[model samples]
Target: MRKFIILSAFAATLFVSCDDTRKVLHEQYLEYVMHTDSLDVVHDAMTVHHDALKTDTRTLAQKLKDVEETDSIAIADLAKHQVLLKEQATSLSKLKKLIESHADVKSYFMSDSISVEQMEAQLVEMEANNTDIAARLTQIKTELKMIEAEQESLKKTEKH
Candidate 1:
Protein backbone atom coordinates (compact mmCIF):
# COMPACT_ATOMS: atom_id res chain seq x y z
CA MET A 1 0.00 0.00 0.00
CA ARG A 2 2.89 2.42 0.84
CA LYS A 3 4.60 1.70 -2.51
CA PHE A 4 1.34 2.27 -4.40
CA ILE A 5 0.89 5.72 -2.84
CA ILE A 6 4.41 6.77 -3.79
CA LEU A 7 3.88 5.65 -7.39
CA SER A 8 0.62 7.55 -7.60
CA ALA A 9 2.30 10.74 -6.44
CA PHE A 10 5.08 10.36 -9.04
CA ALA A 11 2.55 9.80 -11.80
CA ALA A 12 0.62 12.88 -10.76
CA THR A 13 3.80 14.95 -10.87
CA LEU A 14 4.53 13.80 -14.46
CA PHE A 15 1.01 14.64 -15.53
CA VAL A 16 1.32 18.11 -14.05
CA SER A 17 4.62 18.66 -15.84
CA CYS A 18 3.09 17.61 -19.15
CA ASP A 19 0.12 19.89 -18.61
CA ASP A 20 2.41 22.88 -18.01
CA THR A 21 4.32 22.29 -21.24
CA ARG A 22 1.08 21.89 -23.19
CA LYS A 23 -0.18 25.14 -21.82
CA VAL A 24 2.97 26.95 -22.89
CA LEU A 25 2.78 25.51 -26.38
CA HIS A 26 -0.85 26.51 -26.63
CA GLU A 27 -0.05 30.03 -25.59
CA GLN A 28 2.69 30.32 -28.18
CA TYR A 29 0.30 29.13 -30.87
CA LEU A 30 -2.25 31.69 -29.79
CA GLU A 31 0.36 34.44 -29.85
CA TYR A 32 1.42 33.59 -33.38
CA VAL A 33 -2.16 33.66 -34.58
CA MET A 34 -2.89 36.94 -32.90
CA HIS A 35 0.25 38.52 -34.30
CA THR A 36 -0.61 37.36 -37.79
CA ASP A 37 -4.09 38.76 -37.52
CA SER A 38 -2.79 42.12 -36.35
CA LEU A 39 -0.31 42.24 -39.18
CA ASP A 40 -3.06 41.55 -41.70
CA VAL A 41 -5.05 44.45 -40.38
CA VAL A 42 -2.01 46.71 -40.62
CA HIS A 43 -1.30 45.62 -44.18
CA ASP A 44 -4.85 46.35 -45.27
CA ALA A 45 -4.71 49.77 -43.75
CA MET A 46 -1.37 50.49 -45.42
CA THR A 47 -2.71 49.48 -48.82
CA VAL A 48 -5.66 51.82 -48.48
CA HIS A 49 -3.42 54.66 -47.35
CA HIS A 50 -1.00 54.06 -50.20
CA ASP A 51 -3.82 54.24 -52.71
CA ALA A 52 -5.09 57.45 -51.20
CA LEU A 53 -1.60 58.98 -51.30
CA LYS A 54 -1.21 58.13 -54.99
CA THR A 55 -4.48 59.84 -55.76
CA ASP A 56 -3.52 62.91 -53.75
CA THR A 57 -0.12 63.14 -55.44
CA ARG A 58 -1.78 62.92 -58.85
CA THR A 59 -4.17 65.66 -57.88
CA LEU A 60 -1.29 67.91 -56.79
CA ALA A 61 0.50 67.34 -60.07
CA GLN A 62 -2.61 68.19 -62.05
CA LYS A 63 -3.29 71.22 -59.89
CA LEU A 64 0.22 72.54 -60.47
CA LYS A 65 -0.47 72.65 -64.20
CA ASP A 66 -3.55 74.86 -63.77
CA VAL A 67 -3.25 76.71 -60.48
CA GLU A 68 -1.53 80.15 -60.42
CA GLU A 69 -0.28 82.38 -57.62
CA THR A 70 -2.99 84.79 -58.66
CA ASP A 71 -5.50 82.13 -57.81
CA SER A 72 -4.93 82.16 -54.05
CA ILE A 73 -8.19 80.23 -53.71
CA ALA A 74 -6.98 77.07 -55.43
CA ILE A 75 -3.53 77.39 -53.82
CA ALA A 76 -4.90 77.22 -50.27
CA ASP A 77 -7.13 74.30 -51.15
CA LEU A 78 -4.23 72.36 -52.61
CA ALA A 79 -2.12 72.99 -49.50
CA LYS A 80 -4.89 71.65 -47.27
CA HIS A 81 -5.20 68.55 -49.45
CA GLN A 82 -1.44 68.02 -49.30
CA VAL A 83 -1.47 68.21 -45.51
CA LEU A 84 -4.15 65.53 -45.34
CA LEU A 85 -2.15 63.29 -47.65
CA LYS A 86 0.98 63.70 -45.53
CA GLU A 87 -0.97 62.68 -42.43
CA GLN A 88 -2.35 59.55 -44.09
CA ALA A 89 1.06 58.51 -45.31
CA THR A 90 2.51 58.91 -41.82
CA SER A 91 -0.20 56.75 -40.28
CA LEU A 92 0.29 53.97 -42.86
CA SER A 93 4.04 53.88 -42.26
CA LYS A 94 3.66 53.70 -38.48
CA LEU A 95 1.21 50.82 -38.64
CA LYS A 96 3.44 48.91 -41.04
CA LYS A 97 6.42 49.19 -38.70
CA LEU A 98 4.33 48.18 -35.71
CA ILE A 99 3.16 45.02 -37.47
CA GLU A 100 6.65 44.10 -38.55
CA SER A 101 8.16 44.49 -35.07
CA HIS A 102 5.49 42.74 -33.04
CA ALA A 103 6.72 39.14 -33.51
CA ASP A 104 5.69 38.20 -29.99
CA VAL A 105 2.40 38.65 -28.25
CA LYS A 106 2.05 38.15 -24.51
CA SER A 107 -0.50 35.62 -23.31
CA TYR A 108 -1.48 37.54 -20.24
CA PHE A 109 -2.51 40.72 -22.00
CA MET A 110 -3.88 43.08 -19.43
CA SER A 111 -5.26 45.16 -22.24
CA ASP A 112 -5.75 44.55 -25.92
CA SER A 113 -4.31 48.02 -26.44
CA ILE A 114 -0.79 46.96 -25.49
CA SER A 115 1.96 47.69 -28.01
CA VAL A 116 5.69 47.24 -28.38
CA GLU A 117 7.72 50.24 -27.24
CA GLN A 118 10.11 50.30 -30.17
CA MET A 119 7.24 50.18 -32.60
CA GLU A 120 5.57 53.11 -30.88
CA ALA A 121 8.79 55.12 -31.07
CA GLN A 122 9.03 54.46 -34.79
CA LEU A 123 5.47 55.69 -35.18
CA VAL A 124 6.25 58.89 -33.33
CA GLU A 125 9.17 59.57 -35.64
CA MET A 126 6.92 59.03 -38.63
CA GLU A 127 4.47 61.55 -37.26
CA ALA A 128 7.23 64.11 -36.86
CA ASN A 129 8.32 63.53 -40.45
CA ASN A 130 4.75 64.05 -41.57
CA THR A 131 4.59 67.37 -39.75
CA ASP A 132 7.74 68.59 -41.46
CA ILE A 133 6.48 67.41 -44.84
CA ALA A 134 3.24 69.27 -44.29
CA ALA A 135 4.98 72.52 -43.45
CA ARG A 136 7.25 72.28 -46.48
CA LEU A 137 4.31 71.46 -48.73
CA THR A 138 2.42 74.48 -47.48
CA GLN A 139 5.38 76.71 -48.25
CA ILE A 140 5.73 75.29 -51.74
CA LYS A 141 2.07 75.83 -52.44
CA THR A 142 2.35 79.46 -51.41
CA GLU A 143 5.34 79.94 -53.69
CA LEU A 144 3.49 78.22 -56.54
CA LYS A 145 0.58 80.63 -56.23
CA MET A 146 2.90 83.59 -56.42
CA ILE A 147 4.52 82.30 -59.59
CA GLU A 148 1.11 81.55 -61.08
CA ALA A 149 -0.10 85.08 -60.40
CA GLU A 150 2.98 86.57 -62.04
CA GLN A 151 2.45 84.42 -65.13
CA GLU A 152 -1.23 85.30 -65.33
CA SER A 153 -0.47 89.03 -65.12
CA LEU A 154 2.17 88.67 -67.85
CA LYS A 155 -0.40 86.98 -70.07
CA LYS A 156 -2.91 89.72 -69.33
CA THR A 157 -0.42 92.50 -70.22
CA GLU A 158 0.47 90.73 -73.46
CA LYS A 159 -3.20 90.51 -74.41
CA HIS A 160 -3.46 94.30 -74.01
Candidate 2:
Protein backbone atom coordinates (compact mmCIF):
# COMPACT_ATOMS: atom_id res chain seq x y z
CA MET A 1 0.00 0.00 0.00
CA ARG A 2 1.07 3.69 -0.31
CA LYS A 3 1.11 4.10 3.50
CA PHE A 4 3.39 1.10 3.90
CA ILE A 5 5.86 2.43 1.35
CA ILE A 6 5.91 5.87 2.97
CA LEU A 7 6.55 4.39 6.42
CA SER A 8 9.41 2.29 5.11
CA ALA A 9 10.92 5.35 3.42
CA PHE A 10 10.76 7.32 6.68
CA ALA A 11 12.46 4.49 8.57
CA ALA A 12 15.26 4.33 6.01
CA THR A 13 15.83 8.10 6.23
CA LEU A 14 16.10 7.96 10.01
CA PHE A 15 18.54 5.08 9.83
CA VAL A 16 20.72 6.91 7.34
CA SER A 17 20.64 10.05 9.47
CA CYS A 18 21.78 8.12 12.55
CA ASP A 19 24.60 6.48 10.57
CA ASP A 20 25.82 9.82 9.24
CA THR A 21 25.80 11.35 12.70
CA ARG A 22 27.85 8.46 14.05
CA LYS A 23 30.37 8.79 11.22
CA VAL A 24 30.85 12.48 11.94
CA LEU A 25 31.34 11.79 15.64
CA HIS A 26 33.90 9.08 14.92
CA GLU A 27 35.90 11.43 12.72
CA GLN A 28 35.87 14.05 15.43
CA TYR A 29 37.03 11.53 18.00
CA LEU A 30 40.00 10.63 15.79
CA GLU A 31 40.98 14.26 15.46
CA TYR A 32 40.77 14.71 19.21
CA VAL A 33 43.07 11.72 19.71
CA MET A 34 45.63 13.20 17.35
CA HIS A 35 45.53 16.51 19.15
CA THR A 36 45.95 14.81 22.50
CA ASP A 37 49.02 12.98 21.21
CA SER A 38 50.54 16.21 19.96
CA LEU A 39 49.97 17.87 23.30
CA ASP A 40 51.62 15.01 25.14
CA VAL A 41 54.69 15.22 22.93
CA VAL A 42 55.04 18.95 23.48
CA HIS A 43 54.55 18.60 27.23
CA ASP A 44 57.24 15.96 27.47
CA ALA A 45 59.75 18.08 25.59
CA MET A 46 59.01 21.05 27.84
CA THR A 47 59.50 18.96 30.94
CA VAL A 48 62.88 17.74 29.77
CA HIS A 49 64.04 21.24 28.92
CA HIS A 50 62.87 22.51 32.31
CA ASP A 51 64.74 19.79 34.14
CA ALA A 52 67.94 20.53 32.27
CA LEU A 53 67.73 24.20 33.10
CA LYS A 54 67.16 23.42 36.76
CA THR A 55 70.20 21.18 36.84
CA ASP A 56 72.39 23.76 35.15
CA THR A 57 71.23 26.46 37.54
CA ARG A 58 72.03 24.29 40.53
CA THR A 59 75.51 23.51 39.22
CA LEU A 60 76.26 27.15 38.58
CA ALA A 61 75.05 28.09 42.04
CA GLN A 62 77.31 25.52 43.60
CA LYS A 63 80.27 26.79 41.65
CA LEU A 64 79.52 30.34 42.74
CA LYS A 65 79.47 29.28 46.37
CA ASP A 66 82.84 27.58 45.95
CA VAL A 67 84.52 30.61 44.40
CA GLU A 68 87.36 31.74 46.70
CA GLU A 69 87.50 35.46 45.81
CA THR A 70 84.37 36.71 47.51
CA ASP A 71 85.82 40.22 47.69
CA SER A 72 86.40 40.54 43.95
CA ILE A 73 83.88 42.80 42.21
CA ALA A 74 83.74 40.40 39.28
CA ILE A 75 82.84 37.55 41.60
CA ALA A 76 80.19 39.72 43.21
CA ASP A 77 78.65 40.44 39.80
CA LEU A 78 78.68 36.74 38.94
CA ALA A 79 76.97 35.94 42.23
CA LYS A 80 74.24 38.45 41.49
CA HIS A 81 73.67 36.96 38.05
CA GLN A 82 73.53 33.49 39.58
CA VAL A 83 70.84 34.64 41.99
CA LEU A 84 68.75 35.91 39.09
CA LEU A 85 69.18 32.60 37.29
CA LYS A 86 68.00 30.76 40.40
CA GLU A 87 64.89 32.88 40.56
CA GLN A 88 64.11 32.19 36.94
CA ALA A 89 64.65 28.50 37.50
CA THR A 90 62.23 28.59 40.40
CA SER A 91 59.62 30.29 38.27
CA LEU A 92 60.09 27.64 35.61
CA SER A 93 59.62 24.91 38.19
CA LYS A 94 56.32 26.40 39.25
CA LEU A 95 55.18 26.52 35.64
CA LYS A 96 56.11 22.89 35.13
CA LYS A 97 54.08 21.91 38.16
CA LEU A 98 51.09 23.86 36.94
CA ILE A 99 51.25 22.19 33.57
CA GLU A 100 51.52 18.76 35.11
CA SER A 101 48.47 19.41 37.22
CA HIS A 102 46.55 19.91 34.02
CA ALA A 103 48.16 16.98 32.26
CA ASP A 104 44.88 15.60 31.07
CA VAL A 105 44.62 17.94 28.15
CA LYS A 106 41.82 15.96 26.55
CA SER A 107 39.68 16.17 29.65
CA TYR A 108 40.35 19.86 29.85
CA PHE A 109 39.15 20.37 26.29
CA MET A 110 36.10 18.17 26.75
CA SER A 111 35.12 19.59 30.10
CA ASP A 112 35.22 23.11 28.78
CA SER A 113 33.48 22.13 25.54
CA ILE A 114 36.28 23.70 23.64
CA SER A 115 36.25 23.58 19.87
CA VAL A 116 39.07 22.01 17.87
CA GLU A 117 40.25 25.40 16.74
CA GLN A 118 40.56 26.55 20.33
CA MET A 119 42.53 23.47 21.22
CA GLU A 120 44.90 24.07 18.32
CA ALA A 121 45.35 27.68 19.39
CA GLN A 122 46.30 26.57 22.89
CA LEU A 123 48.76 24.06 21.50
CA VAL A 124 50.44 26.73 19.41
CA GLU A 125 50.67 28.96 22.45
CA MET A 126 52.34 26.19 24.41
CA GLU A 127 54.86 25.62 21.63
CA ALA A 128 55.68 29.29 21.52
CA ASN A 129 56.23 29.39 25.24
CA ASN A 130 58.50 26.39 25.10
CA THR A 131 60.56 27.95 22.35
CA ASP A 132 60.93 31.17 24.32
CA ILE A 133 62.04 29.27 27.39
CA ALA A 134 64.57 27.34 25.34
CA ALA A 135 66.06 30.52 23.92
CA ARG A 136 66.35 32.04 27.36
CA LEU A 137 67.99 28.90 28.69
CA THR A 138 70.55 28.97 25.91
CA GLN A 139 71.36 32.58 26.64
CA ILE A 140 71.76 31.85 30.32
CA LYS A 141 74.03 28.92 29.63
CA THR A 142 76.24 31.02 27.42
CA GLU A 143 76.50 33.72 30.07
CA LEU A 144 77.38 31.13 32.68
CA LYS A 145 80.16 29.73 30.47
CA MET A 146 81.60 33.18 29.97
CA ILE A 147 81.51 33.82 33.67
CA GLU A 148 83.32 30.57 34.34
CA ALA A 149 86.00 31.44 31.82
CA GLU A 150 86.47 34.85 33.45
CA GLN A 151 86.75 33.22 36.85
CA GLU A 152 89.49 30.95 35.54
CA SER A 153 91.38 33.90 34.06
CA LEU A 154 91.17 35.71 37.38
CA LYS A 155 92.54 32.70 39.19
CA LYS A 156 95.50 32.56 36.81
CA THR A 157 96.26 36.27 37.27
CA GLU A 158 96.09 35.90 41.04
CA LYS A 159 98.58 33.01 40.93
CA HIS A 160 101.06 35.24 39.03
Candidate 3:
Protein backbone atom coordinates (compact mmCIF):
# COMPACT_ATOMS: atom_id res chain seq x y z
CA MET A 1 0.00 0.00 0.00
CA ARG A 2 2.84 2.43 0.80
CA LYS A 3 4.51 1.62 -2.57
CA PHE A 4 1.25 2.29 -4.37
CA ILE A 5 0.89 5.65 -2.61
CA ILE A 6 4.44 6.71 -3.53
CA LEU A 7 3.97 5.73 -7.18
CA SER A 8 0.67 7.59 -7.40
CA ALA A 9 2.24 10.75 -5.90
CA PHE A 10 5.18 10.59 -8.34
CA ALA A 11 2.87 10.16 -11.31
CA ALA A 12 0.75 13.07 -10.24
CA THR A 13 3.83 15.27 -9.93
CA LEU A 14 5.07 14.23 -13.35
CA PHE A 15 1.74 15.09 -14.96
CA VAL A 16 1.72 18.53 -13.35
CA SER A 17 5.27 19.16 -14.48
CA CYS A 18 4.35 18.37 -18.08
CA ASP A 19 1.26 20.52 -17.89
CA ASP A 20 3.23 23.48 -16.60
CA THR A 21 5.78 23.12 -19.36
CA ARG A 22 3.03 23.13 -21.98
CA LYS A 23 1.42 26.21 -20.45
CA VAL A 24 4.71 28.09 -20.57
CA LEU A 25 5.26 27.08 -24.18
CA HIS A 26 1.79 28.25 -25.12
CA GLU A 27 2.45 31.62 -23.54
CA GLN A 28 5.70 31.99 -25.43
CA TYR A 29 3.98 31.16 -28.69
CA LEU A 30 1.38 33.84 -28.09
CA GLU A 31 4.04 36.39 -27.31
CA TYR A 32 5.88 35.52 -30.50
CA VAL A 33 2.68 35.89 -32.51
CA MET A 34 2.07 39.31 -31.04
CA HIS A 35 5.57 40.44 -31.93
CA THR A 36 5.11 39.29 -35.49
CA ASP A 37 1.81 41.12 -35.79
CA SER A 38 3.38 44.30 -34.49
CA LEU A 39 6.16 43.99 -37.01
CA ASP A 40 3.68 43.56 -39.83
CA VAL A 41 1.88 46.73 -38.80
CA VAL A 42 5.11 48.70 -38.82
CA HIS A 43 6.12 47.25 -42.19
CA ASP A 44 2.80 48.28 -43.69
CA ALA A 45 3.20 51.81 -42.39
CA MET A 46 6.72 51.99 -43.80
CA THR A 47 5.44 50.95 -47.21
CA VAL A 48 2.85 53.72 -47.21
CA HIS A 49 5.40 56.30 -46.13
CA HIS A 50 7.84 55.11 -48.78
CA ASP A 51 5.25 55.44 -51.51
CA ALA A 52 4.35 58.95 -50.39
CA LEU A 53 7.99 59.93 -50.38
CA LYS A 54 8.35 58.72 -53.97
CA THR A 55 5.34 60.72 -55.09
CA ASP A 56 6.62 63.83 -53.36
CA THR A 57 10.03 63.42 -54.99
CA ARG A 58 8.45 63.22 -58.42
CA THR A 59 6.34 66.30 -57.75
CA LEU A 60 9.39 68.24 -56.61
CA ALA A 61 11.28 67.18 -59.71
CA GLN A 62 8.45 68.35 -61.95
CA LYS A 63 8.34 71.69 -60.17
CA LEU A 64 12.07 72.14 -60.66
CA LYS A 65 11.75 71.55 -64.39
CA ASP A 66 8.70 73.78 -64.80
CA VAL A 67 10.04 76.80 -62.89
CA GLU A 68 10.75 79.86 -65.02
CA GLU A 69 14.33 80.64 -66.03
CA THR A 70 14.13 84.03 -64.28
CA ASP A 71 13.58 82.31 -60.96
CA SER A 72 17.09 80.92 -60.75
CA ILE A 73 17.21 81.27 -56.97
CA ALA A 74 13.98 79.32 -56.56
CA ILE A 75 15.21 76.72 -59.02
CA ALA A 76 18.44 76.32 -57.09
CA ASP A 77 16.60 75.93 -53.82
CA LEU A 78 14.20 73.42 -55.34
CA ALA A 79 17.07 71.49 -56.83
CA LYS A 80 18.80 71.29 -53.48
CA HIS A 81 15.61 70.10 -51.83
CA GLN A 82 15.14 67.51 -54.56
CA VAL A 83 18.62 66.15 -53.94
CA LEU A 84 17.92 65.85 -50.24
CA LEU A 85 14.68 64.05 -50.99
CA LYS A 86 16.46 61.60 -53.26
CA GLU A 87 18.99 60.78 -50.55
CA GLN A 88 16.22 60.16 -48.03
CA ALA A 89 14.38 57.95 -50.48
CA THR A 90 17.50 55.90 -50.98
CA SER A 91 17.99 55.49 -47.24
CA LEU A 92 14.36 54.51 -46.80
CA SER A 93 14.61 51.95 -49.58
CA LYS A 94 17.60 50.36 -47.93
CA LEU A 95 15.79 50.22 -44.62
CA LYS A 96 12.79 48.62 -46.26
CA LYS A 97 15.04 45.96 -47.70
CA LEU A 98 16.52 45.29 -44.31
CA ILE A 99 13.09 44.87 -42.83
CA GLU A 100 12.11 42.51 -45.61
CA SER A 101 15.13 40.35 -44.97
CA HIS A 102 14.28 40.05 -41.29
CA ALA A 103 10.61 39.27 -41.95
CA ASP A 104 10.92 35.50 -41.60
CA VAL A 105 9.11 35.53 -38.29
CA LYS A 106 7.17 32.35 -38.94
CA SER A 107 10.24 30.23 -39.51
CA TYR A 108 11.88 31.56 -36.42
CA PHE A 109 8.79 30.93 -34.32
CA MET A 110 8.26 27.43 -35.63
CA SER A 111 11.84 26.29 -35.08
CA ASP A 112 12.23 24.22 -31.93
CA SER A 113 15.98 24.49 -32.01
CA ILE A 114 15.95 28.16 -31.04
CA SER A 115 16.07 28.80 -27.32
CA VAL A 116 13.64 31.16 -25.61
CA GLU A 117 16.41 33.50 -24.55
CA GLN A 118 17.68 33.79 -28.12
CA MET A 119 14.18 34.54 -29.41
CA GLU A 120 13.71 37.19 -26.72
CA ALA A 121 16.99 38.82 -27.69
CA GLN A 122 15.95 38.90 -31.31
CA LEU A 123 12.64 40.47 -30.40
CA VAL A 124 14.43 43.18 -28.47
CA GLU A 125 16.69 43.94 -31.40
CA MET A 126 13.77 44.05 -33.82
CA GLU A 127 11.85 46.40 -31.54
CA ALA A 128 14.80 48.75 -31.37
CA ASN A 129 15.19 48.74 -35.13
CA ASN A 130 11.49 49.38 -35.57
CA THR A 131 11.71 52.36 -33.24
CA ASP A 132 14.58 53.83 -35.20
CA ILE A 133 12.79 53.35 -38.49
CA ALA A 134 9.66 55.02 -37.14
CA ALA A 135 11.61 58.03 -35.96
CA ARG A 136 13.36 58.38 -39.30
CA LEU A 137 10.04 58.19 -41.11
CA THR A 138 8.64 60.94 -38.92
CA GLN A 139 11.66 63.14 -39.55
CA ILE A 140 11.40 62.59 -43.28
CA LYS A 141 7.74 63.50 -43.23
CA THR A 142 8.47 66.73 -41.37
CA GLU A 143 11.20 67.70 -43.81
CA LEU A 144 8.97 66.97 -46.74
CA LYS A 145 6.25 69.17 -45.31
CA MET A 146 8.72 72.01 -44.76
CA ILE A 147 9.98 71.71 -48.33
CA GLU A 148 6.46 71.76 -49.68
CA ALA A 149 5.71 74.90 -47.70
CA GLU A 150 8.83 76.55 -49.07
CA GLN A 151 7.77 75.67 -52.57
CA GLU A 152 4.39 77.26 -51.97
CA SER A 153 6.07 80.42 -50.67
CA LEU A 154 8.23 80.52 -53.78
CA LYS A 155 5.12 80.27 -55.93
CA LYS A 156 3.57 83.21 -54.09
CA THR A 157 6.70 85.28 -54.72
CA GLU A 158 6.61 84.35 -58.42
CA LYS A 159 3.02 85.59 -58.69
CA HIS A 160 4.12 89.05 -57.51
Candidate 4:
Protein backbone atom coordinates (compact mmCIF):
# COMPACT_ATOMS: atom_id res chain seq x y z
CA MET A 1 0.00 0.00 0.00
CA ARG A 2 2.81 2.43 0.90
CA LYS A 3 4.71 1.60 -2.29
CA PHE A 4 1.60 2.17 -4.34
CA ILE A 5 1.08 5.59 -2.77
CA ILE A 6 4.69 6.61 -3.43
CA LEU A 7 4.48 5.52 -7.04
CA SER A 8 1.23 7.43 -7.50
CA ALA A 9 2.81 10.65 -6.17
CA PHE A 10 5.80 10.25 -8.42
CA ALA A 11 3.59 9.67 -11.45
CA ALA A 12 1.53 12.76 -10.72
CA THR A 13 4.57 14.99 -10.45
CA LEU A 14 5.94 13.60 -13.67
CA PHE A 15 2.66 14.04 -15.54
CA VAL A 16 2.21 17.75 -14.88
CA SER A 17 5.79 18.71 -15.73
CA CYS A 18 6.05 16.41 -18.72
CA ASP A 19 2.80 17.55 -20.22
CA ASP A 20 3.87 21.18 -20.49
CA THR A 21 7.52 20.43 -21.09
CA ARG A 22 6.60 18.39 -24.10
CA LYS A 23 4.40 21.19 -25.33
CA VAL A 24 7.36 23.59 -25.13
CA LEU A 25 9.63 21.37 -27.16
CA HIS A 26 6.88 20.72 -29.65
CA GLU A 27 6.20 24.41 -30.04
CA GLN A 28 9.89 25.20 -30.54
CA TYR A 29 10.10 22.56 -33.21
CA LEU A 30 7.03 23.99 -34.90
CA GLU A 31 8.52 27.48 -35.13
CA TYR A 32 11.80 26.07 -36.29
CA VAL A 33 9.91 24.32 -39.03
CA MET A 34 7.87 27.37 -39.96
CA HIS A 35 10.89 29.67 -40.17
CA THR A 36 12.67 27.03 -42.16
CA ASP A 37 9.74 27.09 -44.58
CA SER A 38 9.55 30.87 -44.88
CA LEU A 39 13.18 30.92 -45.90
CA ASP A 40 12.70 28.76 -48.99
CA VAL A 41 11.29 31.31 -51.38
CA VAL A 42 13.01 34.17 -49.63
CA HIS A 43 16.40 32.60 -50.24
CA ASP A 44 15.57 31.51 -53.78
CA ALA A 45 14.26 34.93 -54.67
CA MET A 46 17.40 36.56 -53.46
CA THR A 47 21.06 35.52 -53.35
CA VAL A 48 20.74 31.77 -53.86
CA HIS A 49 19.24 31.08 -57.25
CA HIS A 50 21.54 28.19 -58.03
CA ASP A 51 20.67 25.26 -60.30
CA ALA A 52 19.60 22.96 -57.49
CA LEU A 53 17.13 25.60 -56.32
CA LYS A 54 15.35 25.23 -59.64
CA THR A 55 13.94 21.96 -58.43
CA ASP A 56 12.65 20.86 -55.00
CA THR A 57 15.74 22.20 -53.30
CA ARG A 58 15.92 24.88 -50.61
CA THR A 59 16.84 25.17 -46.94
CA LEU A 60 13.32 24.12 -45.88
CA ALA A 61 13.76 20.91 -47.85
CA GLN A 62 14.98 19.38 -44.63
CA LYS A 63 12.12 20.59 -42.43
CA LEU A 64 9.76 19.23 -45.04
CA LYS A 65 11.52 15.90 -45.15
CA ASP A 66 8.23 14.05 -44.68
CA VAL A 67 4.71 15.41 -44.89
CA GLU A 68 2.34 12.50 -45.04
CA GLU A 69 0.70 13.70 -41.82
CA THR A 70 0.88 17.21 -40.35
CA ASP A 71 -0.63 16.42 -36.98
CA SER A 72 2.55 15.01 -35.59
CA ILE A 73 4.87 17.10 -33.43
CA ALA A 74 7.35 17.10 -36.26
CA ILE A 75 4.94 19.08 -38.39
CA ALA A 76 2.64 20.65 -35.86
CA ASP A 77 2.82 23.94 -37.67
CA LEU A 78 1.54 22.21 -40.79
CA ALA A 79 -1.07 24.54 -42.20
CA LYS A 80 1.28 27.47 -42.58
CA HIS A 81 3.96 25.20 -43.90
CA GLN A 82 1.55 23.75 -46.42
CA VAL A 83 0.44 27.12 -47.70
CA LEU A 84 3.98 28.43 -47.84
CA LEU A 85 5.10 25.21 -49.42
CA LYS A 86 2.74 25.51 -52.34
CA GLU A 87 3.25 29.23 -52.82
CA GLN A 88 7.01 28.94 -52.57
CA ALA A 89 7.04 25.99 -54.91
CA THR A 90 5.02 27.91 -57.44
CA SER A 91 7.22 30.94 -57.01
CA LEU A 92 10.31 28.82 -57.42
CA SER A 93 8.96 27.33 -60.63
CA LYS A 94 8.15 30.76 -61.98
CA LEU A 95 11.50 32.12 -60.95
CA LYS A 96 13.29 29.21 -62.58
CA LYS A 97 11.40 29.80 -65.78
CA LEU A 98 12.25 33.47 -65.64
CA ILE A 99 15.90 32.68 -65.14
CA GLU A 100 15.90 30.08 -67.89
CA SER A 101 14.28 32.57 -70.23
CA HIS A 102 17.07 34.97 -69.44
CA ALA A 103 19.74 32.49 -70.31
CA ASP A 104 21.00 34.84 -72.99
CA VAL A 105 21.15 37.67 -70.49
CA LYS A 106 23.09 35.54 -68.04
CA SER A 107 25.43 34.49 -70.83
CA TYR A 108 25.82 38.10 -71.85
CA PHE A 109 26.68 39.09 -68.31
CA MET A 110 29.19 36.28 -68.13
CA SER A 111 30.59 36.98 -71.58
CA ASP A 112 30.79 40.74 -70.94
CA SER A 113 29.15 41.62 -74.26
CA ILE A 114 25.51 42.57 -74.27
CA SER A 115 23.49 45.03 -76.36
CA VAL A 116 21.62 47.89 -74.64
CA GLU A 117 18.27 46.43 -75.73
CA GLN A 118 19.03 43.08 -74.15
CA MET A 119 20.12 44.79 -70.95
CA GLU A 120 16.89 46.79 -70.81
CA ALA A 121 14.81 43.67 -71.31
CA GLN A 122 16.69 41.84 -68.60
CA LEU A 123 16.26 44.80 -66.28
CA VAL A 124 12.50 44.83 -66.81
CA GLU A 125 12.26 41.11 -66.16
CA MET A 126 14.30 41.44 -63.01
CA GLU A 127 12.19 44.34 -61.73
CA ALA A 128 8.96 42.39 -62.13
CA ASN A 129 10.35 39.26 -60.54
CA ASN A 130 11.86 41.25 -57.70
CA THR A 131 8.52 42.83 -56.91
CA ASP A 132 6.72 39.50 -56.91
CA ILE A 133 9.37 37.85 -54.79
CA ALA A 134 9.34 40.71 -52.32
CA ALA A 135 5.60 40.48 -51.88
CA ARG A 136 5.72 36.74 -51.31
CA LEU A 137 8.52 37.12 -48.81
CA THR A 138 6.59 39.77 -46.90
CA GLN A 139 3.60 37.51 -46.59
CA ILE A 140 5.66 34.57 -45.45
CA LYS A 141 7.57 36.65 -42.94
CA THR A 142 4.39 38.02 -41.40
CA GLU A 143 2.92 34.56 -40.99
CA LEU A 144 6.17 33.25 -39.59
CA LYS A 145 6.31 35.97 -36.93
CA MET A 146 2.81 35.23 -35.76
CA ILE A 147 3.51 31.55 -35.31
CA GLU A 148 6.84 32.26 -33.69
CA ALA A 149 5.20 34.43 -31.08
CA GLU A 150 2.67 31.74 -30.30
CA GLN A 151 5.43 29.22 -29.88
CA GLU A 152 7.28 31.59 -27.55
CA SER A 153 4.25 31.97 -25.33
CA LEU A 154 3.78 28.23 -25.16
CA LYS A 155 7.39 27.82 -24.15
CA LYS A 156 7.13 30.40 -21.39
CA THR A 157 4.10 28.67 -19.97
CA GLU A 158 5.82 25.34 -20.09
CA LYS A 159 8.75 26.77 -18.18
CA HIS A 160 6.47 27.49 -15.28
Best by TM-score: 3
- Can you rank all candidates by lDDT, best first? 3, 2, 1, 4
What lDDT would each prediction earn against the true structure?
A: 0.51, 0.56, 0.67, 0.49
What lDDT tens digits, residue by residue, belong to model 2 across residues 25-60?
445545645544554455466446545644654564
Where is model 2 poorest over a 10-residue stretch in terms of lDDT? 95-104
Per-residue lDDT tens digits for candidate 4, residues 20-121, read 654554444344334444444455644333232323223333434443432345244444444555575566567546544533344453332554445445
Which residue pairs show backbone clashes in model 3?
A: none
Steric collisions counted per model: 5, 0, 0, 0
lDDT of 4: 0.49
Per-residue lDDT of model 3, residues 26-81, tens digit only: 46656655654565576567557656755765675576577565477777777777
- Candidate 3 local distance difference test against the native: 0.67
TM-score per candidate: 0.40, 0.45, 0.63, 0.37
Off by over 4 Å in 4: 1-104, 109-114, 154-160
Best by lDDT: 3
